[model samples]
Target: MKRGAETRTERRDDAPRDHLLDRLFRSEAPRLARFIRKSVGNQDEVQDLVQETFVSFVAAARTGKLRTPEAYLRTIARNLLWGRARRPQHRDALHLPVDEDFEIAVAPEQEWMMEASDFLRRYEQALAELPARTREVFRLHRQEDLTYQQIAERLGLNVRAVKYHMRKALLYLDSRVNTDD
Candidate 1:
């Protein structure tokens, strides 16, 4: 076989993997974006984080089989977030003014308060969107600090049902509260 034929054979061999990666990207990108948005205030940064997560996920996927791809993607995103947090900020020394008395004032507390209020508002909206039973389950578990078994007993549901509702509630809330929306 000629070199051209060999290249074509290699491309044909990779077609299935490429298709799988494309499907994975389509399905998981929005979910990952929402997850990252919870921690990242800036939409651009959230997008960048999600892109980085998928880039790492694709690299890993190409290397070996992933038993739980969703979980692996989340782990990659978390590591990227931590890495960004640990990176030190750099300022240009050449741009600094020669005057010794120059000072810069920043109101970090006010900025923090604004971000907190916005998050709370979004969280409340997400909670309100949940089904009544799911919302109650979440409130009982989170606000009242009840165990799953206790919540099950209180709501006359099986423990599994309570757990299911909690999971549904969390996923819905996470998707709804994303700043990208």
Candidate 2:
């Protein structure tokens, strides 16, 4: 009613968006987690994904673009869940050139060559550093096309021991392998 005084709607419209997000998180988090858990089957990751959903919703809400906060949040959550569902399969899916009609000339840079060389050296070093038996079992099984039973017979060891060493070698290599390269 007074000049220069904000109306209730104006005050609410200008309120810090985080407070609204916090309120939404406090209220809807459990429901969202339960909803995600039914599909994801992991409680710990469900909470994290729900939090991520809230964060994305907050970012969108901060722009003051939503007409219905609750509905928008649920929609965002569903989309995030859908994306998660597709992520693993998508990564392993075969990726081909989008523009197959175009022939793009490609060349590796000197930096890339150097990185590749360094990566190979590191990989070799990691393999060399494994325990002798583990390295031998891994090399025999992977490089020599020998099965665990064959390696065990050749090495005069139990098949179980050969398997255990192979597993250890593989785990070690997996931890050391440079997937990015």
Candidate 3:
């Protein structure tokens, strides 16, 4: 009983320290995110860097090497920014905070939507290879965003058949996608 009481006391002491760390980290994240965003010009990419920075800081802290955590974090952020600036343009890099290039690349009038439509068209073709009932049910639920019961009522089929068709369609799609990859 005495040993258990001591263990509980130790845990109580550590809990507040953990809570403090959580609060500190949360406070630091938004500031870091905004700094990266203004410096690099991509909000989404800044979010990624903030996550990566926190992960690295946690790892380093775990190993007892964090003497000045804020300074360490700033050093990591600067290095990441510099490295991103130096990377080649054509590399298939993960998302990095980039300036006007990102805006131009992601504009709606550009090829992004066209490429997405092409992929969807291919998916529809693959879906059509299914039986008529399966394809119709899957399309109503997925593409047209109809509920299962709605599809059942509209098609005059039982709900169970609709569910079975959806299941088979999903399996077929999974197999086809894995093979294509």
Candidate 4:
């Protein structure tokens, strides 16, 4: 076969995948952007994170079929956010201005502490919203550091029931705390 013909054939084979990717990007990018924006205050960083999420999604899609692409995109975006959170801040350099007299900068640690406190407040509020039994199960497992079996025994419930309460508590918390408005 001619080289030119092979190139055309390869393009034809790739067309469907390309179309699928384009469609996915169109549908998912806004949702992903909103998700990232909730966590990141910077618009530039939000755009960068959204682009990175799509890049990772495309690379994974090329390797194998994604069973749930939307969820996978969310997982990828969440991991990126976590990774960004773990990195040290360079804001001191970035925010330095020409006029030293008018400088206005907050320390990174202070900002982190504020965020942590806010997260804790939201978490407590969400936990408060849970049913009494579910809240008890969560507190026993998380705050008191009890195993499911231990919690079950302590509460006079079966292991399966304890697991169910924990699951319910977790889903409720996730929806309340992690959801993007």
TM-score of each: 0.51, 0.40, 0.40, 0.56
lDDT of 2 by residue, 1-181 (tens): 6744667667777676657667877888888887877656457878888889888876776666665666666767777765664454422333347696867443333333345455656778889999998899998876555678889999999999998998888888878876665
How accurate locally, in lDDT, is each candidate? Answer: 0.79, 0.72, 0.70, 0.81
Residue-wise C-alpha lDDT for candidate 4, range 1-181, written one tens digit per residue? 6999999999999999999989988999999999988877779988999999999988878887776788788878987876665454622224455675786667655576456445656777898899999999998876545689989999999999999999999999998888553
> What is the alpha-carbon RMSD of candidate 1 to the true structure?
11.2
Q: Report model 3's TM-score to 2 decimal places.
A: 0.40
Residue 75's lDDT in candidate 2: 68
Model 2 ranges with Cα > 4 A deviation: 1-15, 89-181
Ranking by TM-score: 4, 1, 2, 3
Give the winner by TM-score: 4
Residues 1-181 of candidate 1: C-alpha lDDT, one tens digit per residue = 5999999999999999899888988999999999888767679988988999988888878877876787788878866765554343311112445576887553553354445556656888899989999999998887555689989999999999999999999898888777665
Candidate 2's C-alpha lDDT? Answer: 0.72
Candidate that beats the other on lDDT, 1 or 2, i.e. the better one: 1
Q: Which is better, 1 or 4, measured by TM-score?
A: 4
Q: Pick the candidate with the highest lDDT.
A: 4
Candidate 4 residue 76 Cα shift, in angstroms, is: 0.6
How many clashing residue pairs, candidate 2? Answer: 0
Q: What are the root-mean-square deviations of the candidates from the true structure over C-alphas? A: 11.2, 19.9, 16.8, 9.8
